[model samples]
Target: MIDIDIRPAVPADAGAVLDFWKTAAEGTSISDDVAGVTRLVQRDPGALLLAESDGVLVGTVIAGWDGWRASLYRLAVHPSRRRQGLSRALLDAAEERFVALGGRRGDAMVLEANEPAHHAWAAAGYRREDHWRRWTKPLA
Candidate 1:
């Protein structure tokens, strides 16, 4: 495991964040749009936690609090950095941020087919709360 550091993301980190997201393994929902990440960071820098290994952005997780509830989203650890404590550290920081903002409970949505993510979340003290079926409506 390389030396890892977790911290809130700033607008300057957007480029690195988008690069990592795009190069991540297939089947990840990480966005490749630098502009989108920049906007997100500008709006809520505290919600974006980034993990760095030797000055490289290896992981990212977004913790969004909407007054009443907090949701963890877009957690991605670099393929090379797997099995290290980076993900756990990112999650811990995210949860701490949530708690500081008066979040009483938290939630995460992991794809049912993504076993590794599901296991990681479970290991980090999350459990299946309910089954949700998705219905997508495309706008033209």
Candidate 2:
């Protein structure tokens, strides 16, 4: 595992985080812009986990807990930083946070087309549930 600074993202980090996701993340989502990120940090404060090394943004994961469910999203690592243990560290931090907050299961929203991400998630003890399908409707 390489040395990293894992911490929750603050409101000030919204822009950098959105920029980071452009290169690090696999796909796009509706709530991936500055306003959405700022709202997330303001609403939960601790949901967005960021990993920095040498004062640079290297990775991120959103460990969202809505007081009932643990939802993981946007698990991303810098292209140059992949295959290391950053994902593991971020996940460990997220999982620990969930457990501490009375969460039982930590669920992730993984893209089906992202095969590389599949290996990483599986390596972290996350499994896909074929029985469950996500249904979403954009409010906007």
Candidate 3:
């Protein structure tokens, strides 16, 4: 097992987390704008967890709960750190935090075509309930 430390993400962690996000978002529908990420980190500092190895941020998962349901997003692990179970550890930590915050259920939206994500979610005990055909009307 890789030696990693999981901690609540602070504003200072934005840059490192963004680096992981850039790589993870490739070939996927998930997109996170810098300003948006900044706001999110600020809004709920503890909702963002950073996984560090040798004092370097290598993984991240953002979770939130609003008294009813909890949700997880932006779960990314550095390519070099993949397949080491760090992502699972991070997800588990996030779920624990949400549950402690009174979350009764958890949810996440993954691209329908992302098999890896589906598998990961399933492996982590998340089950799909409903499917929706999303539509986007871009205003250019």
Give the alpha-carbon lDDT of every model: 0.80, 0.96, 0.77
Candidate 2 lDDT by residue in tens digits, 1-140? 49999999999999999999999999899998889999999999889999999999999999999999999999999999999899999999999999999999999999999999999999999999999999999999
lDDT of 1: 0.80
**What is the RMSD of candidate 2?**
0.6
Better of 1 and 3 by lDDT: 1
Model 3 lDDT on a 0 to 1 scale: 0.77
Ranking by lDDT: 2, 1, 3
Tens digit of lDDT per residue, candidate 1, span 13-102? 877777777775335443446776777777776988988877888898889887887888878899888888777888888999988999
Q: Is candidate 2 or candidate 3 better by lDDT?
A: 2
Q: Name the top lDDT candidate.
A: 2
Model 3 lDDT, residue 116, Cα: 77
Ranking by TM-score: 2, 1, 3
List candidate 3 segments past 4 Å from native. Answer: 26-31, 131-140
Error of 1 at 15 (Å): 2.1
**Candidate 2 C-alpha error for residue 112, in Å:** 0.4
Candidate 3 weakest lDDT stretch, 10 residues = 24-33
lDDT per residue (tens digit) for residues 17-72 in model 3: 77767776434333355665677778877888888988988888879765676878
Clash-forming residue pairs, model 2: none
Instruction: State how far residue 106 of model 2 sits from its true place (Å).
Output: 0.4
